[model samples]
Target: MVFSWIRKKAADDQEKLKKGDELVIPNQFVCPISLDLMKDPVSLSSGITYDRDSIESWLDGGNFTCPVTNQVLRSFDQIPNHSLRKMIQDWGVANRSYGVDRIPTPKVPVSGIQVSELLFILEDSVESLNGRRCLELVQKVKKWGGESERNRLCVVANGAITVFSAAFDAFARDDSFETNANLLEEMLSNMNWMFPLSQLHSLDHHHTEAAQARLGSRDSLRCLVWLLKCGDLSAKKDSMIALKELVSSDQKHAEALAAIEEASEVLFRLVKDPVCPAITRSSLMVIFHLVSSPSSSTSMAIRSELVKMGLVSLLLELTVDSERSTSEAALGVFDMLCDCEEGKEEAYRNALTFPVLVKKILRVSELATQFSVSAIWKLGRHEKEREKVNIFLAEALQVGIFQKLVLLLQLGCGSVTKEKATELLKTMNPCRPELECVDSVDFKNLKRSF
Candidate 1:
């Protein structure tokens, strides 16, 4: 009779839960991520849990809506409060000692296993197998029924961790050249994991220190490539952050610069990475602000580094990047380039650099032409810098930039222009020896005598 009453009460509660009246998820099973029950069927933090594998299978089975929210859950990541991972080891140990049957009832079944990642570490014996033999082994694992397969997968997963750690150690060792690449490549080819196992295997100070030690070194190239190919923005940025820290060390600067160059090369491919957007825009902003400030070590270092990396052209290219911040930064970078005599000389020496500015000025004649005229006037102000200015100015004028400036002048006449541009034109009076093309009539009325 007592058992019958318990059954009746359980049925009533289950019915209540089905209607969404429950405050907490029934502790029938714990979530792997949170190690908690399906409480509130909430997000990753609510300590709620769900049958992720079940949910995944359900989605595969065409059930698209959440059982609780009735809202369409996009993917497992969207399923409310995730299971806390740290609880898993404790739960597993408790279950093993207490016996799974007698373990205190968890909100969910405290299965002593998880599927966060999979690594396939082939033994020397396994590697010796022909392709056909390997395929046969894979088939057997696939066919192995639930519990047995999970156990084998876990063992392999653990072995994979060992192999990955060893491979990273080998990469650190000077003699492991072929072996490191082979092991890393083999691991990548077979494992479902996204990044190198060492990065994902753990987040201890040891790994952090190892990563730091590699910064600005040839080995750093591999890390950069790996991060670019598989890391999230956070990871990529973290690597860059480490690279940034090492830039202060003179001993590491060379390596750091190489790493930055490597990172910059890969940056274009990561435009979609939400974590680290192109430093190009930020760099442009810095260039703009730096140009306005007086000389400083910080500004000098940044300018030197950017110049070394051939980033000036890249910054100029951002004038066309779809982002306004990037375009503005590009404009600012151009402004900075013209601000310094040494930089102006460098730009003048590079003929290719002049065309883009010339083209921009020609297309957006008013804005581009005005900015160029201002820059030219600034350069012209410094008597000592006149030769460099003249060389660049001659190129600009030859490209018909003069014609575009003339158009802007015609438009500005309506706006009562009173500035460097007006002063510059007056100084270079139309009828002068250098202004041979100025016609007689207009030249006489626009004479400097007025």
Candidate 2:
């Protein structure tokens, strides 16, 4: 019935255009604001009709005047033009033969009241230990948040994160609840959507208390690690994403996450063997946060743990032929890891390390270049081990690092980068004359410069 568009009304209108292959839609059906056919047209006090979404968006930007008439709105009320909506639907049905489907009767947008009520239900269900109810509520929350940006704002602003955090803490504390994978999956799905919202920390005091309770408890964090290790692919993706958001710019939180028994290994495996783009990106971001600790001891501990998990080699493989952001992220973390001697030795062992760094200079991004140079400088420094230093700089020159550094100095760089490139050029400059002499002469005829 929905696809039934070979109707008499449309046939009458289209018959006149039989020879012409153009669609002659009536201008009345279009919204002035968007210049597109209105999906849900409503009338303002200015007596002008526009799409509900468009007008609401205009008003949300703090506008008071009507867009078409330029008249001051007496009231911000939107009267639904039900009759016009029906006409649009009928027209769409009649024109289905012309590549038009009937307009769907848009569901009433979720309201703050509706979200609050759902939170009420979420609270009640969790308190009763009602598994079936919790599952239903999780699906509902996911659907509501997934509907639109407006609905997402409503769900999160109305304290969804706090409620979910409290519920997670509760579930993690209850050993029996661990078996309820069905609810866990749904809950994780719902939380994944909410976690990326920037409004997470803007909740009320009540919400903050719940969030603290969850984070302060070791078991809740352990439960996340459990999900990372044991859950299915979807569950793992959601958990990884949640962990990334949870650790965003919070050194204390990231420290705790790294301290989890198997978290480092899990993160390492995720980077080494990616489940998908998102999983790998999130896992890298989570590690980046952990390695970025401000505390000296914690930073050392995290880097040491990552070395044990073989993160340096894993990141090297990820950097080559990866997407811009992931490559940048992997390189950034690897740059941080290179601060330690073990990380530098491990990365220095890879044949691709020097070439990859030189290849990415000015080719990727400033940060990638900065990170590449930092790592190179750190690995290339071998003052006591003079032979190792010579061999390392030989590899650097073989990979055309000499040209890249000169070009970098010419192209301009940060003050620190400029200083480093200048020194590298000066260091390699003296060697160039001697290397040219040795290359042009046979090995047997070559004599020691000393």
Candidate 3:
């Protein structure tokens, strides 16, 4: 398993490089202290070169002498050995046949001055009302982010998130989405890779930074909503995707999404007339997070708004044969909505609702099956409508769902799911056709009645 390490180790040591499998490392490439190829080979004042980390660690530990030469160092400065670094890179490339991964170039530290300059230009552009300059600055920062992990951390540390957010607010105030379409797209693309939205939520709402972040979050979300409304087909999809990226997978953005009263309406409009399959899924996700909330009573208002917006039928339409992940997401949200009496009624308004839930079982995934079975049980198990309960059960059986449930139980599932499956089976047991070998079991000698 020792590949050797340079900076990797396997061909080298764990602290230095990836150990190459039995590949002999160049003796010179190996650091004197760590005995591994140096990523940032540096020469000490003692005229010895060691891996930068190894040497620096030694110095930081208050050792005044070189580990190899044992000479007292007059100065602790370690000069970067660029030539040795290049040689290491070349050796790695030449030894690729021996399973040596090419050594990546060492990252240079980002300077605070450099990040400050970038931020200044961005702010200047905002002040001058120069759309062109602002667009260029956005592109430059994006390039920095994409260039290296070091650069991204530096930019983010220097308040690039707050700056880009202010840009969105500025553009929103100007109402220049059409004129600045290209810029908007690039910024959205940039935010996708560089922005850490969790930072927005972690702020203390009373602090100044928190106020700035709140402004950023709301303004950026508003800008995305605006794009969804006025942009072209491609832009609309991009904006929806950006919305998803901003909200992420958590309910952290529940209040943010709900506060933007227009977001739900705009997102629902997209779902009803999706620009693409991707947008439909994104809209569903946003709407799901907006409501299908974590027992937040206030979120119920958002749920009501969506249900009134014809969400029930829209979701049912999306639940059938959709991509696996999207299908599971839609079904999950649909199942959550079923918790409410109004959502339940709205769903029942569609005759295919129960049937669709049946179709998803065992066909999609375990989670989808769980959602489907749970919704069916919640809606059909009790005699909510004593008259129609039999009809619902019949419809479930008509779609071969009884067999699906049996199959689900046979294949095994979670305990809650097992309980629901058992209860539904008992409720619908009398309706299933009898056969000894039908459900992989012998003789239907068991009770014919539950």
lDDT against the true structure, per candidate, is 0.44, 0.76, 0.72
Backbone N/Cα/C clashes per model: 23, 0, 34
Better structure of 1 and 3 per TM-score = 3
lDDT for model 1, please.
0.44
Off by over 4 Å in 1: 1-231, 234-279, 286-292, 316-325, 362-373, 379-382, 409-418, 427-450
* Candidate 3 local lDDT, 160-187, one digit each (tens): 6666666666666655557777887776
Best-fitting candidate, scored by lDDT: 2
lDDT of 1 at 376: 55
The predicted structure with the larger TM-score, 2 or 3, is 2
Best by TM-score: 2
lDDT of 2 by residue, 1-450 (tens): 332343445446655644566566667789999988788899999999999999999998999999989989999888888767777788778767777767998766688888899889988988987878877887887887777777887788788877877777667776554677668767778777776534575586666656655743666778788888888899898777767767883566787887778888888888888788988888888888888754567778889878867888878877888888898898989888987777877876778787788777767777788888877887767565667667777777776777777666766678898777777777777666444212111122322222
Candidate 2 Cα lDDT to native? 0.76
Per-candidate TM-score against the hidden true structure: 0.34, 0.83, 0.67
Q: What ranges in model 2 sit over 4 Å off?
A: 1-28, 44-48, 65-75, 175-177, 197-217, 382-387, 435-450
